[model samples]
Target: MLDPLAALRTPDDPPCDVYLTGSVFLDIIFTGLDSAPVRGTESWARGMGSSPGGVANMATALARLGLRTSLAAAFGDDKYGEYCWESLEHGEGIDLSLSRTVPGWHSPVTVSMAYEGERTMVTHGHEAPPEESAPCDPPLARACVAALRPGEGQGWIAAAARRGSRVFADVGWDETGRWDPGDLADLEHCEAFLPNAEEAMRYTRTDCPRAAARRLAEKVPLAVVTMGSEGACAVDGGSGENAEVPAVAVEALDPTGAGDVFVAGFVTGTLAGWPLADRLAFGCLTAALSVQEFGGSLSAPGWAEVAAWWQHVRSFDDQGRAALRRYAFLDALLPGPARPWPLRRAVPTIGFRRV
Candidate 1:
């Protein structure tokens, strides 16, 4: 991948641009399902792809975009874990110095069925044993991405924040059935809080997602709410900046990791100091490109995809001036002598190992 931030490199820069830690899952995606499987019936899919998922999804997305990304997670000592480890560390050029392989542990697996632009997933596996998970000592980086659950904050988040690492957080569903904002104490240390529209509304107790964004902004410096196909909105409490951008239209194959991809894009733009709207648009563009492919991490679009998409859009006569202007930042950021390929997507399945 071309280095988008090459111009900003300094002798004293951090060793990594993004540091991530979470569970890694082996994702097997089945697309083109005509319908949801009926009870007692076998459903066949037209396509299948495999890749690393969970935290690995965000890590891959960030690395593919030329971010120096480090991942800290537990990998099972199994073929599945080997495949995921190899894909992220070797194929995607992510740093796994903080990650470990757990003996006798089963790699978590998620079987995703894509149908009608949505997916149904069945996942199996146990959490990594505490002793086998990532260590408490986090690496210093420009920023870190953390998933805030509906409970006490992860101690590492506060630690990283105090260490001058910008923290960006994504929220999952409130399984406890209590959408208590106080439960997310970690947001205090986060530079941004990203939640889906439904999750935002529930957490903020607001019927409207936009209002929820405003409410969340009070808790975090930046509050972003993704509204699926409609697009996303962000409120920057610090600068009083708010921006919304429409989703780029594309036929989605699988959305398993699209949210992760979007967050990666947004973080990339934010670190680059792009305007608020550009950040949201870049994030949305990356996500739109992601779904057009298959799988999760492997389906992430690198610079190859971004340059190709930009060139293709520029060649067209009808692409609006506004659309071009909105993403004009890419014109200056794309590395010199760049060439576009159809894409740099990984194979439909994890490629076979050579002897």
Candidate 2:
């Protein structure tokens, strides 16, 4: 596969852009929690809000970074699905022509509880993966596949690759139960693969995430395994060397969708012609900033914020480094505690505990 980033500078082709394909869901979040209730008992609720999530978050992140982006995914005709589609359609600058609405399927939904800005989610609606369609425009199609499925999600990717687009793939947690090792033939054609630590460990059946990442890099041109707080490692097939990028220090509130934000940041940086090291740093920074907010996309920082953070951290002289050490000291001294949201008064409490 050709480097989509390089292809962007080609005189004959139009400016390079990204096409996002996958699931988009409505995220309902409950906030203001004091503590999790004992099993079989009712819990109180503090607050609730709904926002756009899933592929919509990824696409929105890319668009917010000033990339030309299009979303290709499935939605239902239900009101929630309509809201999902409308959110993407009205997104600052995203293209939604490729999005399809399935007549009977319900749009995906995720209910989350926020504690100290960190969220725990319960999700539904994964039986409906988007149906593969014929290539629309070859270049656009290639970029599109990168966001959809690669390897196991191969049919569409192969089609797009054959049309000459550089493809990248973001592996999701659902793959843990859904993917079969034999289904990885299509991964051979991927230009880049992004899998979080848990996903990489599960897919490769290895306890060492770096080792698993190396194994994946052996297959694709680039493979990244992100380890929260420990930072991320990127293996370049061309150099056969793995490099580590340290994570930025930040107060983590909710970790929901941090990996997705990371993928969006990495891919955006990749398309911007950033080197591997810088790309990983930017990706980690993006994710760290994401946890400080409540909703997924709503938590993602804009390009200006991302750039400023990057510059500030990179400028760390001895005093700045000392400040970082002090910050780490304070964090260690006062380990943040988890708090569950209060339950609704009308909802009956149910108690259950697992050993």
Candidate 3:
């Protein structure tokens, strides 16, 4: 048995660039569907492909951006579980050695129906509980939390934070019905708390994203609430200040996993030591790029592509443009292709459309 307290004091090694522990799933997306059919009606769907989704997509996005990332999540011993592990292991910059494969239970899966780039999904896997013990090191163990119980997840998060690892927590919808806000003591130790607008509203019982962000900031160092087209707002606990970051306009092909991608970009930018405004812009940029493609992980842009898009958008002198450019240039260390028509097309209200 591992000494839980001793593990918390383990030396901070740079072997893994970033450690991410959360939900992983196999997403089957069907594009070109106008609408979902009735329960008894069968309709033919077109353009099908399988890709990583959920937290797995966030991990992949970070890895593709040259971060030596590791995934510490639960996987069943079944075929779908194996597919998830194999996909992450095969991808560049991802270390899956810490991932555990349990003997029973079905791995998470989702089926998405997309119409002209917009998507709706039906999912399953909430019933399956993750295994408590599996082969994992101290760091990986700190990352994976099998705690479906009220206080369990926060305990693991606390352990990770004590070990000097920068922690980002995503509060999913599963906790909406049952989670008590007081139980989230781990938020006090985390570097950032990212929740979708709906989750923020539920957690704080406030309809305004800004108010929710302020409420969250009272508990954590930084609180960010993502407002789809309205962009995102962040509250800094250190200064009691709030910043509104505008969302980049782009034709959203599929909004699935966009929030997760945004978290990925923001966390990655934070890890890179970028300013708050820049981090938010990078997050919005990554999310915009994600909706441009069909599947979640498949649609995420690599470091080169993101850098190119940032440069293309930076060559403008509009309001808030300088902050956006500085944020991109600071985090995007490598230079790449520059996009033409930086301001006219990049900062639109609806975003760029696919031709």
Candidate 4:
């Protein structure tokens, strides 16, 4: 297993760089598949793994990037809850002091099937605790990562913003087809609002990603729309400047948590005071590296992997060099060529032999 935390900052650090608030889930991932299973056919996966999911994926990604990360979420008293809590606190070095585990409640779970560079997931969860009755104290970190919901999210976001926290807000796909822009009222208190291409377009009533991003930018300080293979585009609401970054080329294994990783990368770049283009480039790079592996939180690439990739890319000829110049911010993060962590599971699970 790779020890990404070996170079982490001291535990006594005052406040973390990012604070995340969302549901914590146990993800059981099945990998090494060429295609989806047919009806009534029993398909066997070559590999199986499990790890923390949901906002935990973002926390792990941020921590892997050397950011002091903290998470505040309710958990269950079950063994799976303990497993996730311990993994986040000890394994990833995330500060979970503000998180709590409720009695009798079970942690949410997601079963993900990975095939052909994509994932099909089925999630199971109990009714969440009321948002008004938070389990623990809220964190006041440099940035806050959260999902926007109607009755929830905005309260803490407004509170965090009042105290100068940069709120990085994201939204999930709305199956309800009620992609009402008013649902995003929380953006008024957010520093940046990021949504996938489909979500953005639907929310903005636009047919194009660029138009969606530009429209959303009018409501928030920054708006970003992520298009899987097409890359990402962003609009700065204040200066009206817009930028686009192409997706990094990679053989994606599982697309699960790529969006969360992208947000983590963008937050990391933003906290480092990088320019808009560099921030988007770094975000795209971080996410591309993630889909090359398996599992959600476990698949995030550490600084070592990033540094190593930069070193390899720099040796490319003129054509490749021009294409890679967008990732120039990497030089500032890594001064020299560095070794890449061996591609292996950060959190591995025992598997059963096929019959």
Candidate 5:
């Protein structure tokens, strides 16, 4: 079979392979704790990190996978904004040609506290006055990751789909108790819709994850519901083929961006035309590796890490390797044994300050 990725090759340097758009924020993360914070108690964290957050998480993950990713979002003219813009564009190699900076506005900020495998986040930002029109003009790419809001992004998602772009849409948790499926009308424009188990259940008014996945599959071409620890399930609306992959087991340090990293892996596999089971397996591994580190965007593993893990799994003795046989598909995706893919250190989480 011809490689789907080969058709996407570009003569120009760094052609956009994936286009992403959504809110951008600087994230301050606090890790290392035995339990949740007690009010009025001064607690010290073992480690602290700060990096560009929100959509930056997905952008960084995609870029680390060697995809030419572009982000279209608004930034502030403030120092924090400049720092985030530089980190994502220069450090992560994400294309920022479509982004904008608004003078007098301050960049959004999120403070995340990771304790006992999960995290709690608090965000702060002022809503800028609405522009006469929407801020983004959709860019053409082989695939697009759409950050959805009720009544927003519908047009752009449709336009991207009309142009044959694969749209993978993710929605935020609805604060209102009403998780109406009517709000998901935009799913018609998306090639795939990825929602966590809770969100999927709420949206579908289903009692369980599998039921939610089935209901979602009824709407979109593909439906994936992420069940933390339990792994994820996907159903193809066209063929009615459904599959689930178990989560890769690992000692998690922080689970901040695991979901986004999973999506990035799935997106990479989808773009490469990998089999559905392989795509889900790859996503699970990507997320498993991500939680072994701290911070959001900076924690994502690169292709080098994937290659290293593949080698490590194969080198295990028969008894040790028995558990990882499920991931044998990784062997085909990895570099040849003679070709060494060196693992590079992850980008440090740098505080945003204009210097």
Candidate 6:
């Protein structure tokens, strides 16, 4: 891990830099499909991979960015759960002290099909029994990633924020077709709210995404609106800072969890005290890099990936000086000639026969 906040760490500081809570899912992704599976006909994918998904996407993304990530979630006793636990705790170095194992419930499973840079996912599983049996209180951390939803109580975010954690909130699609901002009462406790262009427009009732972000800024200290290929824009209500960055051009494979990676990258830059535009660009770059790979959690770019991409693109001299200039901040953050340890793409299965 690169430890982007190493300079700011102290013995008195919270042990974790980022904290999050949500359901972890075992994801099986199928790629290289010419089209969606035909009805009454079988379709075979040319590529497939298995890894942890759901909130694990954001956790893995944060950990890969060198943040001290602590996750509070419930895991199943199934073999798939075992694989997901091993991947996050041991493989990615995430802290799972606040997590627990449900004995009877099986892990949630999501099968995702990737076609034309987008994905369709079908998920199955039963909810684990209530956490009241063994309540796992959240740990103190510098920041928290709160996945907001309508009609869901997020009292823990308020508690964490009171304890000095900067809360960054994002929401899943409002399935009820009611994007009622009033339902999100916890926005008062958050430092920022990140929503895609569509969601932002719906919530703020604005014609343009930037206008939506501006309106959202009135609700939270920071408002971020992500536009698929156009890029992302942010408004900092406190500092009156406005930043917008264009998306990095790259061939996208599986776009699952790309949003999580972008949030992770943005959080890293924010905690590191980078300029607003630089933070926006870094988030765009990390998310773009993630879509080039297979799975969401495993595909998160580490410092090595950042270092390598910087060196390669700079030497190529093709991105144009204006385009590359925004990323000049990376030169100061990367170590001298650091190479990535190894690629960690997901495979077809967790188990393989020994040679």
- Each candidate's TM vs. the true structure? 0.95, 0.77, 0.78, 0.89, 0.90, 0.96
Alpha carbon lDDT of each predicted model:
0.88, 0.67, 0.68, 0.82, 0.82, 0.89
Query: What does candidate 2's lDDT look like per residue over 74-96, in tens digits?
Result: 88788878766766676445777
- How do the residues 1-355 of candidate 1 rate in per-residue lDDT, one tens digit apiece? 5776777889999999999999999888999999999999998888888888889889999998889999989999999999899888987889998888999999999999999988999999998888633457678999999999787669999999998999999988787899998898999899999999999999889999899999999999999999999999999999988899988877888888999999999999988888899999999999999998888887788877787778778766555455587788888877543334553454566667689
Q: Ten consecutive residues with minimal summed lDDT in candidate 2?
A: 342-351
Return the lDDT, model 5, position 259: 90
- 146-258 in candidate 6: lDDT tens per residue? 99978787778888988899999998899998889897888999999988999999988899999999999999999999998999999999888898999988899999899
Residue-wise C-alpha lDDT for candidate 4, range 1-355, written one tens digit per residue:
2322334446654387788888899998888877887889998988777888988899999988878888888888997898888788977789988788888899899989999867788999996676466643356677888798743445777888887788899998776778878777788889899999998999888999999999999899999999999889999999998999999888877788999999988988887777898889888989999987777798888877887778778888774586567877666567543334563353455233459
Q: Comparing candidate 5 with candidate 6, which one achieves the higher TM-score?
A: 6
Indicate whether candidate 1 or candidate 2 has the larger TM-score: 1
Candidate 5 per-residue C-alpha lDDT over 1-355 given as tens digits, one digit per residue, 9 for 90 to 100: 1122665576752357899987889888888877888899987888777778899999998888877799988898997799889889987779998888988999999888999888888999986555567744477788999877854446788888887788999888887767888888888889999899999999988889988999999999999989989999999989999999888778888898899999999999999888898888888889999888777787888867876777776777763385367787766655643222442223335542458
Q: Single out the weakest 10-residue window by summed lDDT for candidate 1.
A: 337-346
Root-mean-square deviation of Cα positions for candidate 5 versus the true structure, in angstroms: 3.5
Number of the predicted model whose lDDT against the real structure is largest: 6
Q: In TM-score terms, which candidate is top?
A: 6
Off by over 4 Å in 1: 132-134, 317-322, 336-355
Q: Per-candidate RMSD vs. true structure?
A: 1.9, 9.7, 8.5, 4.2, 3.5, 1.5
Model 5 stretches with alpha carbons more than 4 Å out: 1-14, 129-137, 151-153, 317-324, 336-355
* Worst-scoring 10-residue span by lDDT in model 3: 341-350
Residue pairs with backbone atoms closer than 3 Å in model 4 (clashes)? none
Which parts of model 6 have CA positions greater than 4 angstroms off? 133-137, 337-340
Separate clash counts for every candidate: 0, 19, 4, 0, 0, 0
Ranking by TM-score: 6, 1, 5, 4, 3, 2
